[model samples]
Target: MKNVIKTIGIWLYILGCLVVGSVFAQDVHFTQYTATPVYVNPAMSGFHGSNYRAGANFRTQWNAVSTGNTYRTFNMFADFALGKPTYYSNYAGIGINFYSDQAGDLNYSTNKVDLNVAYHFILDNKGTNSISAGIQSGFGMRSIDLTNAVFANQGGGFDPLGGETINRERYAMFDVGMGFLWSYSPNKDRSYYLGTAMHHLNQPELSQFTSIGVSDRMYAKFSVIGGMQVPVGERMHLQPSFIVNRQGPSTEINLSTLVSYSFNREPFDKNSIAFGMMYRGPLDAIALLTRVNLETLAIGFSYDVNISSLSSASRSNGGPEISLVYVGKPKNRGSERYCIPF
Candidate 1:
């Protein structure tokens, strides 16, 4: 049964890779729930008003299994709101994110750095509704170190000895995305936000492996993101969100819901703490969530309970992730108003 399960899992992973599916479909960590920070839509950059936002996340996955199968990830991003309230008519932000992943004897490791710029233009601001068109430009490089990776030894590395020096390859790609956000309810207790983003407009070429004669292809991904908050009482609220990602031949869907109970009425100094839980589909896992807000600084943590086939081998450690965010409030008048358009 163990071997069968392993085989099935391997096949599923292969199918997921070969089918030209959504790149964002691969689940990595929990902080992705913050939604806005991940650039799920380019238009989200400065949608939250004139505030500087910074965040980071760390995820450790599959620790229950062998050490090699466990995955670790680290991410950081920051964004600034464009324009001043009294002199500006548009909103925009510039953001940069760095990510690194390690798995399977370090054979499957990925390092990426991305710089993105987003802009939002006010379309209409009716009583309580604000609509804007968001656009973003993404620049990044992805690299892999295959020296000690398990996959490199699968076929025979050098010849008879099955040992070959690990080779590293890196590639750079450009991505363009656009998003639309419709926000309603303003400063009310109950609010709703709707957002949609389409990414990888350039169909980034991820073909570092193709240099050895393997066929490689590039695909575009379109994502839809939206969230609604329903207050149960003065102290508690339920928030549900849906994410849809589609590639050329495959589609991945994620649906999650969380509840946050506040103790201090959303903190006046931008600093507070909240505890919550999340249900993520596709992988069918439950995670514990906690967040800290210190004025312009925010941090989040998530630990997953593996419930899928991987759980049997996971030994219950599943995956753990941590994320951090920093929003920079402008002290001067110059740095606060100059936002490069996406």
Candidate 2:
């Protein structure tokens, strides 16, 4: 019975791949997508409450299923409020980010660096409401180590050379994306925001094999993200956020909520804690997460519980992720007029 179940799980996975046919690499993804905002939307680049913010995230997935086939991702970013805004003045922000992802027996990897810029237009006095437009320009490299790849001809053994003529071992390309965001903040706190982005607008070619007559271009992706913080009590807030992404034949959606309690009474209290649950697309997994906001520092952790048919082989454990962020505070910077959040 156990073997039958395992075989069914494998078939389900193969069927999924067939149904999604050549969905191309949307693999640079995270269950805790909120932890790396800049990587998702350029408009979030410099949209924060403080003068500047920096953060990093790391993720490892599917370790229980295989010792050498787990997927790993790491990314870091820095965003800066370019100029000080007045009660109703428009301003701009800039940011840069780096991302790396790799997985499988072949050690296939994707790495990218991007520069983002955004211009904000204040919609009301006190910078309480605003809209912004942003652009991202980046360079990307996709590579793979074929040393451990086993082809059907190899009969399930490693082959340093698969008797195939490879066109290129790795390649680099230029990539572009754009985004827009709307924000509403009634008081001195995190703003409610809605944003949309279009990535891989240029559809950079990333194929590493010469099997096809033509190389493959990465599928463009569209994303919608929204978030808000609602005060539920004197010292606690309800933080709810969501993201939707579509690339070629693949689509993913995540909805999450966290309850945050401030240990300090300061307006921008850095001492706080938040815990919550999140759900992934079409019953992929359920995640539990917690975040700690300390003085000038924040850390977050999340665990994913898989529920798909693949869970049989994975023991329902999707994996774990962690994030670290430095939330900067400006001293005597003359009343910050811009928003903060990216």
Candidate 3:
């Protein structure tokens, strides 16, 4: 009886999510938003003050809920600057981003590829202030495996012979997004930036039951992100950041702060360690994050502890994520430095 109840509960939760997705909007989420810069905003591509940047991220969640009921996502990006920076100058950037996600026992999955471009306008003679405008175009595919799904009409138990019909299992769509950013930096050691983005401007159709005359369109998503870096001492720095996101009737906000200690005096040499904590508003979850910088490469890891109303079902286990980033400078411009590791 206990096993039956647990199975039923899991099914109910999955059903609720599917219903919400069809009626409202659904998008994949990540705890380490800063690590996946292009996903947060197209204007962030190549914003690291380097000649080129490459990054990858992976996340897995709900592993403790049930076997074969987990969710996973993978993302990768590469971006480069078009021109070298002088005291005051304009520049352009281009990038490519790809990501894939899979969730639930039904094997629902999404894959996307995007191309982005941005133009930067120098606002100060010292090149300390700038604005960036960017746009992105992408194609996405969503699929599901209905053969593994369990329906209420299948009785209270599993039965392979239960007959059910699902007309379609996959769909494809085109997507577009745009963003703007404003950055201020007195020098390399201290900086502040703010940006906003709008995604899914086309409201692409996502319904898999097209044969049944059901049409579902994905809602547009809007986001705002901001962060500031402060130098606490010669070797220590503090950074506070926040992100607000809204799609359809759902909304989320995340706040985080990080403290970094550099082992070397040279800012471009890249030898540092940082630790931070993040909170998802309205008691969603608490996360602990850490990063290590070595030369031109940096690696980060974070774990989330569930604290929401669903914690009882999740057993307080949320998710874990890992990220890797590489920032490279041209030989001619080796003296340039970035204000933050992420």
Candidate 4:
């Protein structure tokens, strides 16, 4: 049987979290970026036309080599928009998000709470064009459970405490991020947006050893996330989206296309179903996504197919993720609904 690789991988995962070894890691990510708009870019804090919105995302990955060891992530967020839909009216957006990420076996976890604020510059009364700027302040904490950790020299023992150390195992930090987004729509039916964000501006030092310069600080991240919506037919529409992330020495890119079939066209809320394929690279994986929308609520699901070098052990199976979004609409405000996410 093969046991060597799994052991090495677990150690690498631990080192990745500590950022003191050759390994380093990035922030948690989900395949359904559409469902986690505010988490992706603070500029999207109040991009939706609704008065308020809320959503959650969950993901579990990498159970191939070891069944008990995997990576899990969860995020929940909500945002509010207050303003009029007029060419001359300006608006302010506010949002809050909380997320937790944990790696199995090591029982390592990171949790963060974030506050997001944005200002939108309405270019026209029709809400055809607008630009937004946003800023984020957050608090983060990380820790590890050595009891579940399989360290060397234990001969794979089942000790309760596993090992002993004097270094601090948990710490917390304050984080800062900001971004800008621009949305443009020639008419009410077609729309697109492009945004860029910078995260980890303070470079939080994530070292379990409690040593400062010895370990590399969390790397600053510059990200580009955008999408477009186009109408190809009366009921069918083409939606393409992408997100590219660069943090420290790592890079991730995901591109997706989903076709939507509308069943009901409500001026304020639309009912539809969408399905599509996504390609994630730098040589990673492909995913299948499906989304359903009913009035003010939408649900999305995605399954990834492992295509990277680790596919052999993963058996080409990546992981599964689910996302939910809800928007609150109060009657009809005396304004035009212009923000459309295709």
lDDT of 4 by residue, 232-269 (tens): 88777788999999987889999999988888653223
lDDT of 3 by residue, 191-235 (tens): 888999999999998765455456678989999999987888998
Q: TM-score ranking from best to worst?
A: 3, 4, 2, 1
- Per-residue lDDT, model 1, residue 249, is 59
Please, what are the lDDT tens digits per residue for candidate 2 over residues 123-207? 9877789898999999988776667644443457753332343556677889899999998887745568899999989988765
lDDT of 1 by residue, 110-139 (tens): 565555566555433333455556566666
Q: What lDDT would candidate 1 get against the real structure?
A: 0.57
C-alpha lDDT (0 to 100) for residue 308 of candidate 1: 69
Worst 10 residues of 1 by lDDT: 159-168
The Cα error of candidate 3 at residue 17, in Å, is 7.3
Please give each candidate's TM-score: 0.75, 0.88, 0.89, 0.89
Model 3: per-residue Cα lDDT at residue 129: 84
lDDT of 2: 0.77
- The Cα local distance difference test for each model comes to 0.57, 0.77, 0.79, 0.79
Candidate number that wins on lDDT, 1 or 4: 4
Candidate 4: lDDT over CA atoms?
A: 0.79
Clashes of each: 18, 5, 0, 2
Q: Which residue pairs clash in candidate 4?
A: 87-124, 87-125
